[model samples]
Target chain A: MSGRAIVVTSGKGGVGKTTATANIGLGLASQGKKVVLIDGDIGLRNLDLILGVENRVVYNIVDVVSGRCQPRQALVKDKRISSLFLMPASQIDEKDAINTDQMRDLSAQLKEEFDFVLIDCPAGIEQGFRNTVAAADEAIVVTTPDVSPVRDADRVIGLLQSSLGEPQLIINRMSMDMVKRGDMLDQQDVLDILAVRLLGIVPEDEAVVIAGNKGAPVVLNGGSPSGDAYGRIARRILGEDVPIPELNGHNSLAKRLGRILFGR
Target chain B: MTLTELIQRIQHSFGKGGSKDEAKSRLLLVLQDDRLGLTAEEKEALRQDILEAIRKHLKIDAEGFTMEFVSSPTDQNKMHVSAPVQVGRGPANFSK
Candidate 1:
């Protein structure tokens, strides 16, 4: 059977679609699945950098689509996992270099060879957005706890639903302390807006930033709380029955907020 | 803003996973308030205006939901709108 192609997308910028893509792709490969990570952001590509393979990128996705290189030649392998490969996007080329038809065909080709194909989509519902969505079997919408990100995520989910069906949600960079203080929206709040299945909720951990700076994903540190969160998400993707634990310890404070949401 | 004040500002019953019907209901709550002090007919106009804005904001067609304003016996200044939001697809509505 051909593998599944899932796109990591967010309509809003800087919501960590690329970061989640790298981690989840690596996480899946660590499970002994052959995974291929595609940087579908075109001109503003960063998946290569997040995977710490930027220095290794020579041929990109555009090179493959434009028929300049075959898929095998464009593949950048990472030794971190058993068999994880990357298809970097062109940095100098524009978004116009690729379209939905080409992407759809390319994804079908990749799926035949890998166990999983993950595309890190660009922000906004433009050409790059449509191109990534065109090839996916399902989608993962990433969002932060703020208003604008939620709003834009809602917009993206709506688009994905019309084309790709309902997309699972990943609530990233959540501040449990703020949620306890009633300052930031909790996972339930975001689920309220999108009404999508909650895939996983990743808490705000500074270790994520430190790991990113060192060109490593937090999920590599099985002991880190944030890594634990992504690991759960990855297992969930493989159809493991994983329960989302209550992230904030002081549930006492948000108790009132939860009750009020239910009733008097 | 003070942490308490910020919390108070955001402490609305907006998120708790259920259905899109919840969003339509919440949108109605956010659309109109008695502070505007418009007449019933004027309030309906404002409601329609806000509905248009919501459709544009969500990038969805108007058919995503339906809304109607209902009369409230207790508060003359307040109007209640009940809405049922339906996604395009069924249980596949969450992920397909």
Candidate 2:
């Protein structure tokens, strides 16, 4: 079967789009699903660093697009999962240097070989963003439970709907304590503004930073809560009915959160 | 307001961000003056009625539009509905 191409994008930066893409690609590949992660943020690429494969990159997407190498040759295989691969972006400042038609053709070719192709989009709705989303069959908009992110997400969602399709929402960096105290915007507050299907909600986890710093995905860590969350997201991506684990900063604030977020 | 005025109101609402193809339409239709004390069914009817009125007024096709009556994101007394021109068709598949 041809794989699905998904672009992970958020209008605003620093909302965990790269982390989520890396983890999702890693998680899917770990389950024996062939996956390839693409970093579409040219000149400011970081998906390779997050995947712990930066040092192994010889040719990048730029190389592949420029006909310097084949798409398969440019892919750097992940040591942890044989089925997972990373296609790094170029380091040059020319974001529009790569041919968009070539990128789309590369995505089409990648879709034939891999079961899932994840593209980590650059922040903001610019050329790089257009390049990232040009070939995606679906989109996932990551946002924090805040007013500004939600507002930006709404604008992004509106744009995606006009072209790509119905983009799903993923709430990242959720602090349950803040939600319980009503200090922050809860899931309902986000859904209230951006009307979209709820994909998965990842709790605010410090392990993300530590793992990224160490050049490893936290999903491989058995004791990591965010790892478990990513695993569930990956399984759900595979059409599994995995129940979302109610993770918070510590204890069981889920029942109250269910009432608050879903109005149950 | 009368139904004709209400339809004009809905048209005016969609005209705010009315960009050609790039900026799809979003409408925030609020029903004021509930002093009529309409029943729940009546209120629901009016909501659907307004949607039909807008569709008829706007001359939109069937497949490319979606109108949702949602609780207002800001004003308590208002309802919001964003009608972006739907592009692709199929169930949403969310990736990690």
Candidate 3:
């Protein structure tokens, strides 16, 4: 089966790129689709730890590219979901250990066996980013509401537009209370600036931190708001037209007043 | 705060519209410049050079000349340089 390869990336670090990758990978797998997660951040691998399969990572992408192990052998299967798998990155190798052509070949090989191949790209516009971007057929850019992350996301979006058409956006760590208080940038504000299609908006749920700490994706348990948001994202990925509910509750007077007062 | 600063704040939001607005405005300018890849001064210089070069071969209405770097209506990341000129002379030679 010819599956779709998508890269999850953020130009800035600590903007939830890896976490989004793990959760979305799990979300797609839980829906009975064959999903494989590849940790593209070679030197600093985190997807394995986030997926709670760090100990089971006997081989990594470096070994596969170097011909020490085959691609299928490097895949670490998830205990919870039999369909979910991860190709962990090498902790000892640098980002330049693998080139773009090799990445493209490996991604093509993996796509033959999986329905969705999600590559967790590293931060920055360096070689690591190029390698991951070369492997993907589409892209998903993750960004927070903060200025720095949003600016970097814009840059990454421009690059992806030149390569992979238009990449979808995921606004993470969005705090509804702050948006109501006019203290934070809302989803609309971000969309206005980024001007891309929104895949999902994950709220600032404390459960995300707890899930990361526990080495399990938030979508696996299915109780938290973030999990529900990811489930909707997965449905959207599967061509389901699920409407995203606004967190600010239908644009109250605070938002209108703020808009008029600020002349925004 | 100074009187001018306080008045600006009052005119904007009465101290209620917080840093989010500031961030949005700043990001807008930065992204526009980043996508355009040229400053106002640089674009003016390039336009003048192009107009001079065009005037050497054909007669054109320099007053009605327009050049713009616009984002594509369909694609946000793509940019198009539109320089529509009104030619005044040489309709026969231009056809060749």
Candidate 4:
């Protein structure tokens, strides 16, 4: 079957691109779709750790591209999900370990087997970013509510729009409390600046941190709000019209401020 | 002035606000410049070229020269460049 290859990226670091990739991949696989999560970060691989399959990684994407091992041999199957797998990155090598051509070939080969190929792209618009974006048919731009990340996300969105068309956005780590208090950028603030299709907004939850510490994705835990958000995002990716609920509490002042600043 | 301080001044001119408003305004200004992909050096060079072209006819105050990018009032997607030149009284206006 001709599958979809999507690259999950944020221009800035520490914005939870790997976590989103792991959860979204697991969420899709939970629906019995064959999903392969590829860690395109190369030397700074973390998707395997987030998916709790680090120990299972023997041969990585670099090894597969360098002809040391076949792609199937390099894939580390998910422990809980039967249809989920991970193509881990090479931790020892640099971001240049795999070039654009090699990544495209690998992604195309995997698309024939897996229903979804979720590539966890590295931060910044460097070689790693180029390689991952080059392999994808679609893109998902993840960002937080902060200033630097939002700016970088805007830049990444511009780049993605020129190449892969308009990428859907995932606003991660949104603090509902702060939004209500007018201390943080709400979904409207982010959407106004980015001007992209909103995929999902994962609320700030302690369960995400705990899941990361345990090396298991929060979506596998099944109780956290962030996990539910990821599941909804996966559904949306499958052409389901899942509405993103309003996270901002009814604060008229904040709404006024949003209207004044964002002109929503 | 640094771009951050300029943005803060612009936001302050908008009157009462919160952290969210400040951030959105700041991002709006920054992303406009970012989308243009023009560096400060490029802008300065462009300013110099404009000064040279205008100096052929009218006198210009090079020291009082200012060029900056401001958010457009009508369209959020567009940017307006504000460069206020002080017309020099002296013919040369050179200290040397």
Candidate 5:
């Protein structure tokens, strides 16, 4: 089969789209698959920072589209992974710098050379969102388990189904402790409202924030729970039957025993 | 006090309940007929059809059941219909 193009997007900002894209790309590349991640956010690009290859970007997507450089020249290879590459977005250019046709052509060309092409889409349902999703074979809509993010994600999913097909859902930054306390929305509530197939659930972890600051994706750390979740998501994307990890955090056993012994 | 006045005074004695009683249940209903590309008349007809279908199938006991016509995200040729019924108990024990 040919390579697949996947777009990681969230309707609202600050829902961890860039982080998920970086981690999933790294996880897939670690499994011996050639992967290329395109930061489609244009002027607000941050995927390079998350991937730890910001200093190596000489050319970007604009250069490739404008014929100033070849696609390979714009692709910055990750030092930690042998088969991973990143096509950084232009920080100075705007969203209209590249049209949908150019993005489609670029994605098609990249698909010819890599096993997977993941596009990090910008937030909001605008031209940038359209351009990035225009070339994707599948789309993953990321949302936190809060009301605002979940509502925005529902709108995004509706748009995707109307424009494309049904996109997969990814619940990011979940907290099991909050769920246990009835202070946070659970995955079931999100699924009930979105009514889409869930791709994965990533728990909120402090290590993810630290990894972001250090310009390293959490999936590379391996010991972090969120990192392991992203690894499982990558395997699932490759059609592996990976089981969803327990999101009960470290208090699952204690909570269960308390419920059994105390009936609370 | 008169008998009727006595009942009213007793009813007023029960003040508003605690935090649990203060918590209200909300149902989010989305109407999507526009996305399906249906004309206004067709949408209205679909809405009427949905209400008629629901009324024909089940007996609505409470005053909270709402029926609406929604647009279909996938195909413009279709319309989505939704109905939200707020019964007294949780839906999991509806059979009882």
Candidate 6:
């Protein structure tokens, strides 16, 4: 059977749709599944950079759509994972350079060869977003715990309900300390408003930024909490009942006692 | 009788006390159905209409009470009317 196409999108910018796409692709690929990550951001593409395959890009999705190269020639295989491949977007081109039909055809072609096809969608509910979602079987929406992000996510959810169907939600960059201090919105509060099934929650880890800067996804680094969370998300996608990770810092009994005594 | 007095008389009849929560919940339900921006005068009319409507449906006496209208974030064009129908009490102390 053909593989499933899943689009990672967010109505607001800086919500980590790209990061989630990269990490999830890596996670799935690590499980011995053939995965293809598509850079649907088009003109402002960064999936290639994040996956650390930027320099090897001989052709992009536009090249395949315009018949300059076949789909196989456009796919850049990741150095670390044999099962994972990336279809990077062209930075110099405009958003209108590629159409939805092309994306649909490309995704259909990829589905034949891979076990999973993940599209990294751009922010905003515009033509670019439309193009990315056109060929997908399902969608994964990424949002932060801030009110603005949640509000934007609600709008996106409404749109998805009207356009696609019920899209799963992923809460990204959640800070447990802020939530404990009542300074940030909690997961339940977001779920109450959105009313969608929770797929995963990624904590606010500094390692994510460092990994992005290094052009390496944190999912490959076993020590990173966010990496482990991404790994669990991948397993969940593969039909494994993986429990969601707890975001609070793990403290020993001595530390807890010390905090209670000192009121720290 | 005044609308406030009628509501109070109804509240007094339902003597099971603690009618404040019931009244608030009932008014919220009605306001949800109204789906319009109800003004103070409109709200007063609604209060009377609701009491009369309830009276026609059931048997009860209402006393000292008030009905307030608020806004809902989900449906911006509608008003949420909350009526605290006090029954058989000195006064229905609605916080707001």
Clashes of each: 1, 0, 0, 0, 4, 14
Compute each candidate's TM-score over C-alphas: 0.74, 0.71, 0.80, 0.82, 0.75, 0.74
Stretches of candidate 2 above 4 Å error? A245-264, B1-96
Best by DockQ: 3
TM-score of predicted chain B versus true chain B for each candidate: 0.29, 0.30, 0.44, 0.53, 0.33, 0.31
The C-alpha interface RMSD of every prediction is 11.9, 18.0, 6.8, 9.4, 13.3, 17.8
Clashing pairs in 3: none
Query: Each prediction's DockQ?
Result: 0.05, 0.04, 0.21, 0.20, 0.05, 0.04
Q: Residue-wise lDDT of candidate 5 within A214-254, one digit each (tens)?
A: 99999998899899999999999999999886553334565
Docking class of 4: incorrect
Clashing pairs for predicted structure model 2, backbone only? none
For candidate 3, lDDT tens digit of each residue in A114-213? 9999999999999999999999999999999999999999999999999998999999999876675456787878888888999999988999899989
Task: After the best TM-score superposition of candidate 6, give how far the Cα of residue A153 lies from its true spot, in angstroms.
Answer: 0.9
lDDT of 5 at A108: 95
lDDT of 5: 0.79
What are the runs in model 6 whose C-alpha is more than 4 Å off? A248-264, B1-79, B83-96
* Candidate 4 chain A: worst-modelled 10 consecutive residues by lDDT: A255-264
lDDT of 2 by residue, A54-172 (tens): 89998899889888899988899999889999999998748887756877888999999999999999899988888778878899999987655666676688779988999988899
- Decreasing TM-score order of the candidates: 4, 3, 5, 1, 6, 2
lDDT of 4 by residue, A55-102 (tens): 888999999999999999999998799999999999999889888999
Give the Å error, residue A41, model 6.
0.6
